[model samples]
Target chain A: MEESATQPPTAATPSATAAKLAMRHVDFHYGPFRALKDISLDIHDRAITAIIGPSGCGKSTLLRTFNRMNELIPRTRVTGDVLLDGTGIYGPDVDVAVLRKRIGMVFQRPNPFPASIYDNVAIGPRRHGRKEPDVQEIVERSLCRAALWDEVKDGLKGPALALSAGQQQLLCIARALAVEPEAILMDEPCSSLDPAATLEVEELMLELAQEYAIVIVTHNMQQAARVSSMSACMMMDPDRAGVLAEYDATSLIFTNPKDKRTEDYISGRIG
Target chain B: MRMSPRLSQNLARAVIWASAVLVIGLLLFILAFILAKGLPTLSWDFLTQNPSDMGRGGGILSTIASTLFVTLVAVVVATPFGVGTAFYLTEYTREGRMTRFIRFGAESLAAIPSIVYGLFGFIFFVITLKMGWSVLSGGLTLAVMILPTIIRTSEEAIRTVPKMYRDVGFSLGATKWQTIATTVVPSALPGIVTGIILAIGRCVAETAAVILTAGSALQLPTSLFSPARTMAVHFYIMAREGISMERAYGTAALLILLILVINVAVNLLVNRFVAKGR
Candidate 1:
């Protein structure tokens, strides 16, 4: 582990007015057990932020916190705040459904709805009552953004599940992008893919980073190294409960991190 | 050292599978035998014409008509309440002693024999509330009898949908009911339909409850308030009285055939629905 420079530059850019999401001292608990403690992070307007952690270290949990996905579980409670732009999302007046339209997500496993390829991407806009953006144009645009259009162009009528494993993952990414979300949260979006597929998805993520703020949680140290500009490493404590040990630039976390656990993790000495 | 343990494990599995198949096969065989023996006596007129106590094995048109009415009404009456109760229990309520109690009560109701249900239906419809013996009373009793089956199966189907799918819908800002309506219901459609089919099969064959609640008039009733005889009750009464056994056998055969044809038709219709359903 190196030192403090791994911390992402906290200064505001001129385009920072569009700064997408921030989690503030956000503490999450499942019943009596704390999952994340004092978690504060800024996901800039259009940059790739990678969260690297051992399993059960709260990376996915933290990713879910952004769009309030954790609300599905009973007894799950959040103590701090999550703000999209300057507005507090957890504010009572905020409609959770409308909020999720702006904060879309791609899961670890490819989960395209049991629908046709066309319907899969069309669902969000239709459900949210977007007076149908040229649906053909939007579906193609989103698929192009996720790098899936070319592969699936001719067979849009096929069931989404009929795609190859890699194509399905990209399709899921396209599904997330179709909603025109300001930020896209991915939970190890490439973990299930092979090397070639992973590379394809990684490239897609980097290209997408140019337009949308992307937060990805990955177990692969190399994936974190390859994709994200800012990175945070979470470690599982002796209690087997997880906590964020360090947050920094990807280069710094891998080449020169501040914590020993981060060092052990990146070097493969320990998980 | 490990040889016997491995062999014993395999033996245990074989016994388990064999017993299951044997029991299920035994039931299937009995059903097949009864159906086969009754088939020769079956005819179109036998199903379309009314049975007469005066004649032998003549017709069961009234029985078929009344049975259809009672079962259709019962299903229509019970489905909404059944689905609502299931959704309430599985989606809204937390897993606790109270939910567990309700679930247990439902399971216990499912365990009750048809005879007990008939007794309840008989007293309530005929004696107590005085709805009298009619297709309406029979339908009411069968509706109550079928509730637990529909609720339990629908609940199981709903609960079996992947939690990830639920989370996806919820994260997208869908209300609890919306998520269920759009995603969960579609996914669980096959299982729910399977349960309904099974329940409908039971309802068609059920004689005790229908006999108690629906007075066997042998004539096709014009309204739900009029007394009528279901096919099973007609067979029961005819066979017990030792009158035209061939006609009773034919009536049984015709009813079974009709049910089979109806199921195949319904399954085809349901299967045509696109992904997320059967």
Candidate 2:
């Protein structure tokens, strides 16, 4: 059931550029089993889009699809059109490495490089071939963006592994920002984090959404409600494999939805 | 419930203490055994003179020099190869049948006897290439034989380097090679160094391959192609064919001292590195 309107969305939002990422009947497979089934949606530009679902559902897999990070895993294949900035990102010309740079990713657990804070942030910009960067400015701006400068400014040279779990996760966010990526794909960024750390990351995500498009996969429905501007729910069909059963704006998905599965999921009846 | 988990864990306290003592005792016994037979024979004459024909009377100065030159060259040769091979396997390559085959080959090579390596050296360097039993041939052979040891240990070191470092570099837009050079290689330095030092020890202690490849000669090595004899080879020759038993004993003492000093230095460096890593 499409949200048919008398007015065309393309004509109305042409100048505004409503979608940062759009998928057209995208399908994903791990060997023979399909993880995402003929799914399609527009990830709103410069807004936090959260995907919520039960374990083993395709929520995390879908977020990974944005940057093509799933290509890193063996036996994983994706089909159909996955577009970024109106360009099909999965086309033959798209370099996965280059694509990854434009759309930075952060994983569930904090994974800071075994290096100094300055080096960690400088890694992305420097790798993409910028030599002798104004490392000081970029590091400061990125960490400040992630709200970690006050905690680690004086100890930039210290090993990043020395930080607590929360600080390390923020460091990862800062690392993602260093490349000046257009979007950030987060795969359960707060799942391994404590509530306090979770709040810190959620707030940071909200703040970051003002600059970069954010698509986060979180199992927490409350987290989906708290941070996301739009929410997508996925479920494994009874006779089928992994699939996106429902997708909608956060307000529409949580309070009132046309799909029975989406309502059951939001109310914790089928979870 | 009555006892703390810590206390219960200490249930094997006696066994652990006894095992520790036994280990220390065994190590000491070996050291003492080597020293007891080797020390008194060490003398200025033993250090300065040449080996007496028929295995005994002369000094090992030339042999000592040859050992140093050969090891220095072999290590220099092995370092790049070992590190490169390790980098390829650990950082660049993905796991598959070919990678698995290469890994298995390296493991098997590491386990193969030094004598087998010596035979391979003799066949390849001397007989096939016709390099004719020289210091260069010996050094090259040793380096090749030690390749597996170097590769295996270096791979372990490189593997231990957290994957995050590579990711950090890649995310920064560092090319595949760039990430390995800047982040992966540097982070694994201590391990690579440890592997190199251990390889150096193997080179120093090795007599089989060098003896088989480089003809055993007492003369100072003047050129890369000239036959040279290492200390271990010299000692082996003395023990088997020397003129005087006293000279052989003296040569033994000197060789033991050299091996002991090098091992101690490596141990100290490795310990310091482990402390830093911690």
The number of the candidate with the highest DockQ is 1
Q: Against the true structure, whose lDDT is highest?
A: 1
Q: For residues B183-229, write the lDDT of model 2, one tens digit per residue.
A: 77767887888788788889988988889988798887888888888
Please, what are the lDDT tens digits per residue for candidate 1 over residues A108-201?
8888778789877776666666565577778889888888888889988888888888998998878777778888999998888999999999
lDDT of 1 by residue, B32-98 (tens): 9768888877777765667655437457777888889989878888888888888899888888998
In candidate 1 the C-alpha lDDT for residue B240 amounts to: 91
lDDT of 1: 0.81
Point out where model 2 deviates above 4 Å: A4-17, B1-20, B36-59, B90-96, B161-172, B242-278
Worst lDDT 10-window in candidate 2 chain A:
A4-13
Error of 2 at A130 (Å): 3.0
lDDT of each: 0.81, 0.80
Instruction: Please give the DockQ score of every candidate, comma-separated.
Output: 0.41, 0.28
Clashes of each: 6, 17
Residue A111 shift from truth in candidate 1, angstroms: 1.4
